[model samples]
Each structure stands twice: as structure tokens, then as C-alpha cells.
Target: MDFYGIDTAPIVGVEPTDLPVIDVNDSRMDFVFLLEDDSYLHIEFQTTFKISDLERFKLYDAALYDQKKRRIYTYVVYGADINEAEEFLDHGSIQYRAHAIYMKGYDGDVIFDRLAKKIHNRETLTDEEQLQLIFLPLMHTKKEREELATDVVELAHQIEDENQRFRLIGATVGIGDKFLADSYIKKCWRC
Candidate 1:
């Protein structure tokens, strides 16, 4: 993951003290970071949108709370945008606060330039405030294969099982269709 403009410094109190793991049954979360205030950040990356994702996070949040008694904030890091996930907040019964991170294939240079400017001025922003930006391509066309690789790289990092990794890579390659394999490159270049 590119941290050039990403503010990972706000994170504190991360648990397990090891690399982020993928075993769902295990207490180790998919991507667990911490807020400056010591709150928990649980991230789940989904390439394929599933209707049950919200509830799944809710269950995870409940489990975390049951174990640690601290408020846990959750986010769904996804390749595509989802309205169904948004609707989950409409129902009154679920109390756990959650949000979605939509990833997209876009002009890496443009996004990086914007992020760089923001990071340079981050010190001017108030404490406890951070930016949440969704990277969706300004132009969305299923034509380009390399564009989709941005999402695939994230998938490779998050999935632990080798078989699953191969399967995901296969799926991502299929998404590319016929574009040159070399087309797959980082959204942003050097800092």
C-alpha cells in the first residue's frame, strides 16, 4: 500500500503486534489499525460485493467489543462502489458505526498529486481529523485491463492462502481481458 500521502501516523494501539492476518476464525483482523484516540480500525477488503458484508462486520465489531470493551470502528475496503452497503445504515437496530472505502482504477498521477498537496498541509488541519478519499476513476470504462490491476494488488496483499491468491489472480487477469500484462502498474509513481 502507498503511504506517501496516506496518514498512517494517526494510528496507535494496533493489536496482535504482527502483520495483518486473514484467518476469519482467528481473532486477528483482516486490517486492524488504531486511531490516535486508541479506537480500533478493522478493515475488510472485498473485490466482489456481497449483500451480507455489513452484517459480517457487525458480527466482527461485536466480537471485538465483547473481547476488549473498546469502541471499534469498521470500514469495508472494496473495489466497487455499493449502495446496498449504504442502506444498511438506514435501519435503526444496528448500533455499530461503519463506512465503506471504494477503490477504483484512475489516473494515479493526478490522485497522487492531490494527495501530496493534502499531506503537505495536513499539519494545518485540526487534531483527530483525517481525510478519507475514494479513488474512483474519473473515466470508467471496462476496456482497460491494467486499470483493474490497482484493485488486484490490494487483493494480493490481503489474501493469505496461496490457493486463494492464485484464484484471485486468475480472476483479476480475467478482468484485464486482453491488455498487455505490463500495463498493470502502481497508481502512483515515486514520491
Candidate 2:
């Protein structure tokens, strides 16, 4: 939660559920967690702004509610390029809303440098730092988004823990799909 700067009750648990409730649907919800508060948290990563994005999420949340009959909190995490977002949609009696987190204020170059220094000194990366690495591509950067992403992938390769290294590298590649060129990611992903 802190990585995205979420301020809520201290989390005690996160259990994964079968979120793909619609078996034949092509649309997918990015991440959902059954939080400690007995409510569900539905999260989506958006690199661009579109009113339709909220519409799609509304449908997904409705489907999820139908399946689980639980309270759902939706949050849209916007990438660096998006400074503002539409947070609410009113459709007659039904109103849909999503909490927004903007990454425009964060500097990717500075985050990378700080994390790189830790790795250079052979320091174990905390879980927060690991998540920061996974999100490095989504932050503002001096270099092109693709370059910063690939560079983080290379830096992740140096992590001492094999499991941690592989997990974070794969996440970087997966998240990079939102903006980075497919060809560029394919070329640098080999590292």
C-alpha cells in the first residue's frame, strides 16, 4: 500500500481469489485482494486516461459483486504520464467511483539511483523497495520510459536472492507492457 502511497488501516492479510469470474470474457481485472478488513480491493494500472476505463471497471466490479456479494473498493493507479483522472461516473441511480493514485510526482531516475546504490553495497532490498523496482517504469524519468524499464530489469538481475530477482524482473516486464515497446522489452527481457 505504501508503494502506491495508500493510507489505510494497517494491513494484516491479503488472500488471492478467483477474480476471473467471467469464464468467457476477454476483459481482465489487473489485481484484486481480499483485505484484512473483510472487504475486497480491486486495483487497475492505467498508463493513459479514458472515461471508458472507468466504465469497464464498473462492469468488472459489478460482476465481482455478483460473484462474491462483498464490498469492493476500486483504485486506479495512473502512470507518470497521467496527471489527472476521472474519478466518478454517475449513471442514474448507480454511481461508480474509483480512488486514484498518480505517479507523476515521483522521479524514476532518483528511485533507480537510490535502489542501485543499495544493490551496489550488497544490501538486501526491503519489500517496499522491491515493489518500487517493479513500478520503476511507471514513474517520471529523464530517459525514455522503455530505457528506464530495461535498465531496472538489468539492475534486478544483480539481486542476491535468486527467487526475489526472478520475481521482480518478471513483474517489471509484465508492467512494462502498459507503455514500453514490445520489441524493446523482448530484446532486453533476456537479461
Candidate 3:
């Protein structure tokens, strides 16, 4: 999981197992990105509003400060609209940053109508966030005799060779997805 120059260990479960649970009243951080500069970024994926979000971030920051002796930047990426999340932190000591990602773009009628039908109809992970799951199908689906022949054709066009492409696409898709794989293929093509 490389972000910029930092190689982050892939975040697995959301549950905070090792970290001590301090009372923040509401906010909960999902993952942490620790950098070489001794600064850490705490990321929280929120789906709902919590009154104690800012306070919790402060508490979490202080706790991390006490343990790691490093600066912590608290951030939240909410799956829903930001209004509720914003209202909870009007004035607070913990300066927090928030971002919103639309989870229902393709699943909902709004953005889906804007794209070409073919783009929308392709087999995709139901949740856009579940893009990581695409690797499983790309690998096994091509090998399975039961899968639609058209999928194999599409995969062949997108990737060259059968056996080699199957393995390469499988490995890359798990970590980077088809977009990255396509980019790499294009770079090689240009060369």
C-alpha cells in the first residue's frame, strides 16, 4: 500500500485491537498511516454523525502522542454526506480535516445515467470501495469453464496471452486493480 513515497502496510481489519481504548465519547479511527518523518496520520471512515468526534480525535491524538511521541494528524473520510459530520465539530481544539466519498454513484441512478451503458453494465464489485475484490474474478473467472466466454475474450483483449496474463492480472489486480494494470500495459506498449 504505497501512498506517495510512503509504503504503508495494508490495513486489514477496522477493529482497534492493540491500541488502548480511550474514551472519546464518539469518534473512532479506522486506520493509521505512519510516515518516516515520525508523524502519523489517523484515518477514520465514518458512516454516521457522532457528537464527540472532535473530542475523540483530540483524545486519540493525545493518546498517540503519549505512546508514540509523534505528531498525529486526524482525518475522516465519511461514506455519506458531510453535513452531519460538519455540524458536530463547529468549534474545537482538535483541528480536523474531513472528506466525503460517494458510495452510491454507480449503484444509484444519478451518475450511472451519465456514463455509457456498456461502462455501467460491466461486472464490477457491487461497492466501488470493494474494487479490491475484482482480482478474484479476473483470475478464477477466466480459468473456470463455466464462466461466459465473452468475459474471457474481454480479458484477452485487455491482457495478452492466456496463462501468463491470467497470473499477472490476478496478482496486480489484488493490489492495484485493472486501471493500474492497464497503465503498465500501455507504458510497455509505448516502449
Candidate 4:
């Protein structure tokens, strides 16, 4: 909801959620939710771009659809380093497409400062701001993502609310696990 304006109201359930397709594809896909509209939302995150990644998403979607017999919509959230990525794959008549969301447009520094001030003031963060804090490390910034991630973790730890602090730290670490260094994630867990 914070990122894409797509309304997936009344989520039925998490369809298979995130079980790695180890026996078959030997790969894992990220968030998947079954919407009330009887469709699936498959959210995948990537820090790098490759044409093959689209095919992997297609394969995952096909497997899910085959099992559930429902339509699936996939969205690939690319990190700031990836300015652009192939949004679709075309092989002869077979066409596979996934919505691409680039983090390059987001100014991480500006957002970080704003959130920091809010936390300093002890103001409760809105839902969107919370999501932004989790993904801030992946957004465009002059500093290295790993460096920004440490700052983000530090900022999250500063939150006065314990639950909010823990949620943000966990989410930031989960996303950072794919791109940020292990040390940054270790720092997050150390909190």
C-alpha cells in the first residue's frame, strides 16, 4: 500500500507464502498473498538486474497458478542501484510480464532525516513512513547502501516505541539481507 497504490483489500490468505521451491527450481520467491478478488500478489525484491530474473519470476508464478488455478500478479521491486530492469519477457508467442518498481526516484537522505526528526520528536510514524524506513537503505543515496543501512538501523533503535523499533529493525534487516553486508544485518540483530 505504501509503494504501489494497488488496493488488495481483504486479503484472503498467504498462498504458499514463501516456501523455497528447492526440490524443483532450487530457488526462493518472496512475499505472496491471496487477495479477496481471488487473485494472487507476488512481490519479489531484487538488487541487481538480469533478464533471467524475469524468467525465474515467470516460472514461480506458473507453478503457483498451476497449483491454485488463479491469476497471479508479480511485482519486482528493484533496488536503487538498478536504474532500470526488463519488465517483461517475450519468447515467441509466450509473453511474461511483471511490474517493475525502481527505488532510484526516492531520496533516501531526505527521507532519513525527516524520519529521524520525527523519531526525535517522539511522533508516531505513519504507515507509509514506516515502510519508507524499512526500504530506505535500498533507495538512492550518495552513501553506500551498507553505510546507509547502519544509519537506518541506528535510527530504528532510537525509536521510543519498542514495538515500532523492533518491527522496523526486523523489516530493514530482512530487506538488507539481500543487498547490504552481513555485518549490517548482524548489527541489526545485535540490537
Please name the candidate that would achieve the greatest lDDT relative to the true structure.
2
lDDT of 4 by residue, 23-134 (tens): 3454567778788888988888888988777888888888787777988888888888897788878898888989888888999999999999999999999988998998
Best by TM-score: 2
lDDT of each: 0.46, 0.82, 0.41, 0.81
Q: In model 3, which runs have C-alpha deviations exceeding 4 angstroms?
A: 1-17, 24-28, 81-84, 87-191
lDDT of 1 by residue, 79-138 (tens): 533323452544576555566555553444454345446445542212211121222221
Ranking by TM-score: 2, 4, 1, 3
TM-score for every candidate vs. truth?
0.46, 0.85, 0.40, 0.84
lDDT of 3: 0.41
Report the C-alpha lDDT of model 3 over 1-191, residue by residue, as the tens digit.
22112234443323231356676444335556665555676755444556566556656766767877966555554432333355234455545444333222222222222222423455332332123222222221213311322232234234333454454334333223222345554543343
> What is the TM-score (0 to 1) of candidate 3?
0.40
For lDDT, candidate 1 versus 2, the one ahead is 2
**Model 2 lDDT per residue over 60-96, tens place:** 8888899878788888888899989999999999999
RMSD of each: 10.9, 2.8, 13.3, 2.6
Question: What does candidate 1 score on TM?
Answer: 0.46
Query: Worst 10-residue stretch by lDDT in candidate 3?
Result: 133-142
Candidate 3 C-alpha error for residue 1, in Å: 9.4
